[model samples]
Target: MDETENGNLSSDYIAWTIVANVLAKQMNMAGPSAAYNGQAPLSEAQMKRIHDYFFGRLHGGFQIAELAATLGMSRTSFFKRFGRTARVTPNQYLQILRVEKAKILLRNENLTLIEIAFACGYADQSHLARFFKRYVRMSPGRYRSKMREEDVA
Candidate 1:
């Protein structure tokens, strides 16, 4: 492998190691249960409004409090209501959406990571890589390479 590839391999290893260690410690600490407790179901109108808000503004800054206010609810209520209805936190949902868009853009092979990151509402390539790895379990560069290889095959 070339020097750049070697460096990236080591970097990836170190990053993932740090993440694993941190996650293990956090997992042991007492935290809110991930289970869905009984709550009032989101109304169809509420569901539609949220869906429209998210899909329409994937490239905009996402603030949970702002979204909660827009939905006419308090932050705490929005958190519980959204989690119960969407099966994920707002941050998680946003990352997944951005990463999914990035995946599509990666397939083009013409767009740089920076371009994709901006288009996907990330601050920079590093920010995009961080969330992409968290949600997709791989770097954007590696994912793009794999997809290209699969297309060729």
Candidate 2:
């Protein structure tokens, strides 16, 4: 590895060690979840507006420009603020939300995989299956079968 990578590895190890020692001593000084320093994250109002817009138009194509417009923010500003607030890029958050909705619909047993895919905002069944496997560690079809088995038992 390069010098920078080695330095980062050591820094990460030191940080984790400090956290581990603190946890062992039952010190709750910083807690596990700490807010980052520097640029402000999105406010609650901004987050709520984003959530409302995203869910309301869940099955359609999204544009960062469109979202930025709704919040009166420039695209660059919106991207940075959203990353800070959500801990993921906007598109990543959208995919996760889509997969979650698909999971819920899968339990119904009435919706076919294609229906679930489109309903959850994926382009098609294969698209849903790809991300579903990535996030849930199984294909949607397999996940549905597992859910059905659990329902019976």
Clashing pairs in 1: none
Best by TM-score: 2
What's the lDDT of the predicted structure labeled candidate 1?
Answer: 0.84
The per-candidate count of clashes, in order, stands at 0, 0
Give the Cα error of residue 71 in candidate 2, in Å.
1.7
Model 1 TM-score (2 dp): 0.64
Q: After superposition, how far is residue 125 of candidate 1 from its true place, in Å?
A: 0.7
Off by over 4 Å in 2: 1-38
lDDT of 2: 0.84
Q: How much lDDT does each candidate structure score?
A: 0.84, 0.84
Across 1-153, the per-residue lDDT of candidate 2 in tens digits comes to 234744777678788999999787785565443323325788899899998888877788689999988988788878888998899988788788888899999998889999999889888899999999988999998999999999999
| Model 1 weakest lDDT span, ten residues long | 30-39
